[model samples]
Target chain A: MARTEIKIGGFGGQGVILSGYIIGRAAAIYDSKHATMIQAFGPEARGSACSAQIVVSAEPIAYPYITTPQIMIVMSQEAYTKFSPELAEGGILITEEELVKTHNLRKDLKHFSIPATRFAEELGRKMVLNIVMMGFMTSVTGIVGVEAMRQAVKVSVPKGTEHLNLNAFNKGFEYGEKLKSGAA
Target chain B: MKADPKGVVAGAYFIDGDHACAEGAIAAGCRFVAGYPITPSTEIVERIAERFPLIGGMFIQMEDEIASSIAIQGAVWGGKKAMTVTSGPGFSLMMEHIGLAAMTETPCVFVDVQRGGPSTGLPTLPGQGDMMQARWGSHGDYGIIALCPNSPQESFDLTIKAFNLAEQYRVPVLVMLDECVGHMTERVVVPPADEIEITPRRYWDGPKEGFLLFKAGPDRVPPMVKAGDGYNIHVTSLTHDERGYPVMTAAAQEKLVRRLIDKIRLNSDAIVECREEQTAGADVVIVSYGITSRIAIPAIEQARREGVKVGHLRLITAWPFPAKRIRELSHHVSCFVVPEINYGQMVREVERCVAGRTRVERVSHGGGAVHNPKDIYAKIMSCGKEERK
Candidate 1:
């Protein structure tokens, strides 16, 4: 890609920064592309709106901040409300189905939703919801290759929890594949 | 000399500038760090605190920035490569000790991950407002070296350079990082220990008896002796003689202060670093540093697309300002455009260097965010128009 700007937004404790890091690492380290990730640095902690912005490009990324994000993955109502309007024209958006209420979304935009939190709970860890979202994002957007993201997730997650996170990822990936195929 | 293997983490990883800076310090054989945690810069010391113990290094969370700054100097005297990290407010508080470090000729590094400032301005946002402050914040007439990193990779690389320069010159080196670069994450490849060269401290190995503590060698840099190394070394901030006694005389002050300033000023060519792009036969050159350099790239490319013949001079080392290079370029280029995150700091230096040889434009912003590429592109276009006229 020439340059793709991605914004991952959610309340704190949702692995918002970790998800962005994984995506950036996948592209920059594994795929040999250049990626720059910037998090919203503020006093916002758990239960407040938080975000991470990543710019992946074939060339070195300049102007680190995102002017108009091409892709936005939102996991909270507050994040959806705050960031959805800033999505670029015809941009892609992915959100957690159970948490965010999608209303007044742009008609020309491509939208996808995953019950990532529910899938993570089924995998016996609610914290891996972001991993599920990552998998879903991989399936829907294809911004990063599957193997690159898998490797990124393996190295990024805490040791001893990789298997559960990978399982959650596969579940979300499968769901996203089904949705893309019009089988959901 | 090659870096110690214990201190090097050799690999490729996606990391933020703050974490990369800590790794760079470790890879450069920095064994001690002291700092009070502050925003944007807190991660730098946090990484140091976590990784230091593993590599047999030391980290201390001092009560404040003042203590943090002095503690690193103490560590240096105890035969350890040391550094302290902070943001705008903390950097302001540490200015006194920066002067102390300069006067005592202590080899150390002070990392200022700048944020919007003048006293706790925007704690979490980016700002290049501290460029001038890094050069002149401390009182007195002493000179210091300051390096500005535009990206996470440069943050890692230049930090090692900062430590190396500090050791070579026995002066505190400043790694000037804005909050944007500090918080931005990118792929940083740290080479193996054997590949990284470290500048060993200039320690005095001769007889300790009657040793002149403040005597300069042939290179004008005084050799050092650790506090516990059985050397009767007297290190004080006061104007001291060769034996390091507090001498209250005009001759002593002149001799001592002149060397302090001359060590860096005279050897500035060796310490200065910058990158030039397409400057030859160009009408305008954009002088920028830190995050602004990165942000100015698009405008430069756009201006080139519009056939404006624009060049780029990215300042990798912000001080001992690159006056000689700027002066030489001023003869060729019709104008110099400087876009910084501050109202007008480095632009003034560019203007001073140009000295009416050419027109200089200031693209200024009061901190919080970086300049829009469109705005810079507009400036480039206008400069091109002015040149045509």
Candidate 2:
């Protein structure tokens, strides 16, 4: 079976790592796919750009790094610019349009630009933009189920705010689904 | 994946490397963890702090790395498998005491999650800058076992291995982790508790009447009794005779140091581990360790597909450098490529091992980033063409 790698990049506090973790866990727990997620944090975890890579494989994974990505998700302009060069031909590039203005995406590559921040703002929480972006990713790639993603987030997130986060994820999934079917 | 007899199974979970190392220590039956919080190394102590209490173990955050090292030694003397985790800077502070553990033949594990250094260079960046330091950090002529774990899962499994080896040899074992492996989060499978075979440090069940703490015995690991065991335990840092007493005599010091050194030196065959990947009929061999080795694997496969006979030798146990294996492989491979995060630390060992037989070239980088596989593969492909000429 072929292996799929997804790269998520954004400035710290964007929940970039949290989104990667959810995707990895959803693939493992729900889809029964072997998954690995790794993050690289700078000393300035609060201000500097943070990046995470999640590899989902139907077969057991040996090495857990993604040098080249088949799917790229960027939450900020800086993240998009940094990761765009690594996207392979025929790859999927799903990014937030509200934060990043423009990207020099290859013509053949599939690109989905969602206003993740705006969607989260409508939900009354800008911090949940990562979940919105993740929902969009799952809709386009079908890499994992939205319910599986919710369960993964519930298990990993700190207790007491599970309901709010679940609502945010569902809203995000709906936002992505509308865009995918050209119904939005 | 085959089931490890040590009750752990493969399951994907999000865990930082430091927490994984702590879990590895616990699974290895390390009941005592004594350490002072040092940056990059702090999370290891934190994970142990949170997990040890839950697992019915002890976690003591000492005032400094020195005290932590001392406490770990004390715990081992008290007949408990103990460990202390630290980084490059803290490792430098614990060197003197590490010598004490060596001379006293204390079987405890000390993990050095290496960062950029030579005195607090980069507190959070990853660097394999401690390879030579691990070998010669502790003073004097002594042999020690140092294992390097490349990923979170290995960090967990190898910590157990470190404890087992230390217990078997009656010496301090070093687990060398870099900042990358110490902090990176990955999916790890934690086996069931009953699956692991844990070997505690060998203790004497002989007569309690006249138990000598440092008596030279058949296993070289003499039976040790604690202070309240009704036996006078004289564990000292000074060069002493086998009775665990200080002896200033030159002949006596020679015998003592010789035995301390000989215990590990004589058993070199049992302590060395080097992992081979597609080395049977290869022209270019990539030699790496820790996290870099994980990258080198895919790079080797890529090179093989491109029609280059490139193989890999990853070091799980860095020190007690795999001299014999490298020397053997040198005769067949055209070149040995040693890639590390440091400028050039481990390459020196690879160069020394293959001396005069094969070319030892290094693709070294030290700015807190890992060597990209493309660079390593290009170097190997270039070396392959040069060999044909």
By DockQ, who's the top model here? Answer: 1
| TM-score of chain A considered alone, across all candidate predictions | 0.98, 0.93
Residues forming the 10-long window of minimal summed lDDT in candidate 2 chain A: A40-49
TM-score of each: 0.98, 0.90
**Candidate 1 local accuracy as lDDT?**
0.92
Candidate 2 lDDT by residue in tens digits, B1-389: 12233323335566767888887787777789888888777888887787777656899888999999999998887767799989888899899888888888888899998888778888878888888888888879787889999878788889888988887878899999988788766667787766676775566777766767788775566655665666767888888876788889989877777777777777767788888878998899999899889777767777788888988898988877888889999999899998898889989988888888989889888747667778888888889889889
Question: What tens digits encode model 1's per-residue C-alpha lDDT throughout B1-389?
Answer: 99999988788889999999999999988999999999989999889989988989999898999999999999899999999999999999999999999999999999999999889999989888888888889888898999999888899899999999998998999999999899999999999999998999998999988888789986689998899889898899999999888999999999999998999989989888999999999899999999999999999999999999999999998988889999999999998999999999999999999999999999988889889888889999999998788
Model 2, residue B247: C-alpha shift (Å): 1.1
Top TM-score prediction, candidate number: 1
DockQ for every model comes to 0.90, 0.46
Candidate models: Cα lDDT each: 0.92, 0.81
Query: For candidate 2, what is the DockQ-based docking class?
Result: acceptable
- Candidate 2 segments exceeding 4 Å error: A1-3, A28-30, A58-68, A76-91, A97-109, A113-127, A145-147, B1-12
- TM-score for candidate 2, please give it: 0.90
Model 2 local distance difference test score: 0.81
